[model samples]
Structures are given as C-alpha cells and as structure tokens.
Target: MKKQDTLSPYIHFDRKDWAELRSSTPLTIDEDDIKELKGLNDELNIEEIVDIYLPISRLLHLHASATRELYESRNVFLQTNVKKVPYIIGIAGSVAVGKSTMARVLKALISKWPNHPKVDLLTTDGFLYPNEVLKERGLMEKKGFPESYDIAELLHILSDLKSGKGRVEAPVYSHITYNIVPSRTQVINRPDILIVEGINVLQPPKNGGGKEIDQISVSDFFDFSIYVDADEKTIFQWYIERFKLLRGTAFRNPQSYFKKYAHISDEEAFQVAESIWNRINKVNLRENILPTRHRADLILRKGEHHFVESIKMRKI
Candidate 1:
C-alpha cells in the first residue's frame, strides 16, 4: 500500500462493509450476461458483482442523479437554456488487471438503473496514434506507454464532448490488425452517462512543464473515476496467460496482427509474452499508470485471485 492510502481525503472499506452499502441495490444482470461481459482470461463472478460492483454502480447512480439536478438548478438560476451533457466517468488501470472487464460490467450495471440511464462506453485504445505514427516515431516497442497516445486529439474530443457537442466521432482501434481502422469511427452522441476507460486516462496534464502553465487533460471532464489495482506479479501472470490463450484463439486468425506467434509452442509463447510484458507493459505501469492511482475518485484493489477484496474511495 502507498503512504497516502492511510491519510485523509479518503475512506477505506473492506469488501464486506462495502457490500453492505449495496443494501437495496438490485442485481439487474444474471450469470449468463456476466459471461459475455468478462474479458479474455478475466474473472467475473456474480458474488463479486453483488459485493463490489453493485455498490460502486449504486454510488455512481446517485452521483449522476445529483449532478443532473445541480445542472438543472444552475440553468434555472441563470434563467437561460443550456444544453445538458452526459456525465463522464473515467476508468484507469494497468494492462491485464481486469480493468476492461470492470468497465464492461459497470456499463451493464449502470445502464440498468431505475431510469435506465443511457450509458455509452469509450475505450482510449482508439486514441492511440495510428500504427504508422508509432513506427514513424520508433515507438512500436512502447505502444502502451503514455507518450504513444495522441494526447492533443484525446483532449480535443473530451473538450467537444463536455461542451454538449453532437455526434463526436472517435477512431476505432482493431486488435486483429493492431492498428487504427481507417475510415471507421464510433460516433458518440450525448448520453446519460459515458464511461471512458483506459490505462492513461487519469494521467496529469502539463508533463514536465512548470506548475505555472495552465493545461487541460481528458480527466478534467470526468464526473467520477476508478483505478483498478493488482500486484505486479498477478497482472504479469494474467498477461502471459492471456497471450497464451490468444495463441490458440485470436492469434490463429489469418488476419491477426499476432499471427506470427500463433504456431509457436507453449514455451516460446510464454517467453515472448514475458519479454514483451517486462519490456513494455511493466515499464508503462510503473512510470505512468500506477502513479495516477492516487488521482482516482475510487480504487478497486484486487487480490491475487482477481477478486476485489477492498476498495479505497476518495471522500466526496
């Protein structure tokens, strides 16, 4: 645990106590639905949902409702008509820490609330510079690193989204091709809630610039945020396992970007995956992702088994 964890401006909760906070929150999704929501090699149990996710979902529901009311009240006070934009929620974490699964599950739960709030999910993988750009910059080996993303473009999209812009288009990233899909875009119109999930979403702006400089970051637009956490060993194991699993699955596809590894034996796949993880993902996590954990509104700390055993929430 970090030193700041025990300090003020935050409230710590064990899993049991947190689960009680769920009290009357209904379980809207079933086991069958969760199966589809889980990421490859990720674990998602109904009990985990009832314990951890439900409470957070309920909390977000209340927050969103309150935010909407405040927005309406401000409009009335000013005696002017203003467009209400969607409440943006940011989710940040390291690779293979079950963050994608958390985002999907949260979307499923939050979208099923009483009013059935319209929820849209946007992953920042699309905001990564196109493959060619990475190659041009000689950063293919640092693909998930902070410097690899198109930060300016990401901030522009967030600015547009927060200003109640209609029909903002986001680039689409393809896993099979490991590149941005040309001519394809995911148009995001206004919704009740928008979940922006990525590894670097919580990063601070004005990197290396003096404190005097004014800057904007994508996180500035978030109404709420979450950081998924797990030990390095656990995440490393998960990543390697995911790579091995994909060898027999996604990697085998003829058009797969990793098709070259599809026929590699288990030992070879493990070694390659380990090398990639040690070189790229680990460094990115240590240098960029993990440092932003303290900036999240909430942190979901997972045990080795991939279940969140505790949560740390910043005081509202």
Candidate 2:
C-alpha cells in the first residue's frame, strides 16, 4: 500500500468507509448503464457504482443545492435579479487513467437528480489546436500539453456558459481523424450541470509559450473538480493495453489516423505504443498533468485492477 500523504489537506477514506456514505442516495443506475457508461478497457461493476460514484453524486447534488440557495440569498440582499449558472465540474487526469469513464458515470448519475435532469459533458479534445495548427506550431508531439490547446477559446466558452449564455458552440474533434473537425461544432444550451473533462483542466496558468495569463484560469470556473490518479507505472500499463485494443478496433477503420498500426505484428504494436507513450504521453503526465493533481477538489486513486481503492476529499 502507498503511504498516506501526511501533510495533505484532504480527508481520506478507504473503500469500505466511503461506501458507507452512500446512505439513502438511491441507486438510480444498474449494470446495463455501467456497460454503456464505461470507456474501452475500463471496469465498472454494480458495487463500484453503489460504493464510489453514488456518494459522489450525493455530494455534488448537495453542493449544487447549497450554491443555488446562496445565489438566491445574494439576490435578496442586492435586490437584483440575475440568472443562476450551471454548476461546472472539472475532471482532470493523465491519459488512460480512466477519468473519461468516471466523467460519463458522473454525468449519468447526477442527471438522475430531479432538479438537475439536464446535464452536459464536454471534453477538451475539441479545444485542441487542429492538426494543421499544431504542425505549424511544431507541437504535434505535445498534443495534450497545455501549449497545444487553444486556452483562450476554452476560457471564452466556459465564461459564456458561466454567464448563463443560452447557446454556446464548441468545436468537434474526431478521434478517427485525430484532429478537430472544421465544419462541425457542439451547441450547448442551458444545462443544469456541465462536466468538462481533460488532462489539464485543473492546471494553473502556465504564463509561458508566449501566451497571455491573468488571475483567472480555467479551473476558476469549476464549482467542483476531480483528479483521477494512479501510480505512473500502472497508468503506463493501462495506456499500452488500451492502445492494443484500439489497434484491433478503431485502427482497422480506413479513415483512422492510425490505420497503419492495424496490421502491425503484436511485437511491433507494443514497441510503437511504448515509444509513443514514452515520448509523448509519459512526458506530458510527468511534467504537465500530474503536477496539477493537488489542485483538485477530490482525488480518485485507482489501484492495479483499475478500481478506485481510495478517495481523498478536500476538507471544508
């Protein structure tokens, strides 16, 4: 077992203890929903939902309720009427650590709440600079790094949503093409909640790469944030496993950007996946993603079998 973080500000909970917190939070989902919500190569059983994600849904719902009450109180004090914005949730983690799966699960669970039936999820991949733009900036190798994203645009979209914009558009990204689709966009109307998932959503201002920086940041818009974490070695193995699965599936598509990998021998696939992870994904995790883990409002630490072994919630 990994040693506890002695000086950490978070109140930690073991799986069994955390499971106890799910008291009376109705089990709104079942195995069928789990099979749909989980991502490729990820695991999600009914117990995990009852123990881990149910408590999480309960917490987020409570927080959102409190926030709405506070907003209404402010209106009473100021004697002015303003709209209540959607509660934004930021999910951050290294590649292949199962953050995406958790995001989907949370969105599904939270939407089951009566007051927050309309939930929307948006991933930051669409905010990445298009392949052409990255090629021009010589940042194709740094695709998931902070510098490779259009931070300004992401910030604008979040700002608009927070200001209660009725409709906002985010670009569409195609994993098959491995690039942003120029002609398509996702239109987000008013939602009771929004889940924004990405590797670096919790990142502080870089104040580098010749970019503009200020007191405000992407995370500032988040009412609650989560970081999915595991040991680097564990994450690396998961990445390789997911890559192999993709090679057999998505890579076989003629339009896949990685089609060449589809026919490669198993040994060759391992080497290529290893090289990509080492050169790009691992470096990004070490330097950019993992460093922001402490900034999260909660941390979900997964064990070797890809199950959340423990949780750490920031103390109030």
TM-score, one value per model: 0.95, 0.96
Each model's number of backbone clashes?
0, 0
> What tens digits encode model 1's per-residue C-alpha lDDT throughout 1-316?
2224545777888888899899799999998998899988988889999999999998998899899899889889999777868999999999999878998999999888989888899999998898899999999999988789987777878888778887789999999999999999998888879999999999888656654323667799999999999999999999999999999889988999999999899999999999999899999999999999999999999998899988888986
After superposition, the stretches of candidate 2 with alpha carbons farther than 4 Å from their true spots are: 1-6, 208-213
Candidate 1: count the clashes: 0
Off by over 4 Å in 1: 1-6, 208-214
lDDT of 2 by residue, 1-316 (tens): 2235668788889898888888899988888888899989998999889989999998998898998898899889999787758889999999999989999999999888976568999999999999999999999999999989998899999999888788999999999999999889999998889999999999887565464545558999999999999999999899989888998899999999999999888788889999999999999999999999999999999998999999999978
Clashing pairs in 1: none
Worst 10 residues of 2 by lDDT: 206-215
